[model samples]
Target: MVDNIFKTAMRWALIFAAACLLLWVIMPEWKSVCAGLLLGVFASFLNALMLRRRVEIVGQAAGGNRRMGMGLGSRIAMVLLVAMVAYKNPETFNLPATLAASMVMPFFTLVSAFLHHKRH
Candidate 1:
């Protein structure tokens, strides 16, 4: 599920990049890119949480602690990403980016848990 969420995020990034470059001809507001990033982050996190359903198989497994492998690195990366956004436009950063980034890490962790269960 971690892999799935990362893959899903990558796919979303590609689609978003293309839209940012191409769609600007139609909708010139670069703010749309920011909006899209907000939505993309939301969607990726939602996808991650949805994928966590795979962890339900833990009931059948001979598990011990059964913990998600999502560690500090990914979280640190997300934090840095958010910080970058904040620094790039401190006064101007909107609520959506802040909210979306806040939600992504737990979603990634949940999906990581699902992947752990699936591995067993």
Candidate 2:
């Protein structure tokens, strides 16, 4: 199940990256937009990795301990880090696009989960 989620997330990220590259090639003026999208894709990938690892940790627990690996604060920090990067360089990062891109992970994850649930 987790593997499926990871694969779906990666597939979406790659698709988005490819689209971003194409957009960059077609409209060089929107380079900042592309960069922001790429950054979002990267953040999503990191989130997926952390999620996978957390699932593995729970699965491998000796008993019924339902502990999580990376806490909510750490995840929020990651989001803030991305925001900070864009905040530090609004001209280059495109704060609006960066914020939009940051949402890709959770959006796709929900989609994947819904699809998985429907299939089951």
Candidate 3:
């Protein structure tokens, strides 16, 4: 079930990334915005992957005595790193677009999961 959701989310993210790349190539004026979006989307994908791995780890440790966290700290760090990069390279990346794009994966995942649930 988790694998299905992860795969669906990743598929959507890849589609979005392709669209962004197409836009970047076709529109020179929107290059910075598209680049920022691409960076954010990439980071979001990585974060999603990390989350999925942590979830699996937690599931495996469910019957154990040790507690496992969802790796929120690492995820937060990744977002911060992306944000800092965008902030430092304003000419290359649009800060707002990058920040906004960074949030897209979770939305995609949520929608995918909801649709899957409804279908089943």
Best-performing candidate as measured by TM-score: 3
Tens-place lDDT per residue, model 1, 37-70, is: 5544644454444444435445434476564544
TM-scores of the candidates are 0.34, 0.82, 0.93
lDDT of each: 0.53, 0.78, 0.91
Please say which candidate is ahead in lDDT: 1 or 2.
2
Evaluate residue 51 in candidate 2 and report its C-alpha lDDT on the 0 to 100 scale: 68
**Which residue pairs overlap in candidate 2's backbone?**
none
Of 1 and 3, the candidate ranking higher by TM-score: 3
The C-alpha stretches of model 1 lying farther than 4 A from their native spots are 1-9, 21-25, 30-70, 87-95, 98-120
- Assess the local accuracy of residue 72 in candidate 1 as a C-alpha lDDT between 0 and 100: 45
- Worst ten in a row by lDDT for model 1: 53-62
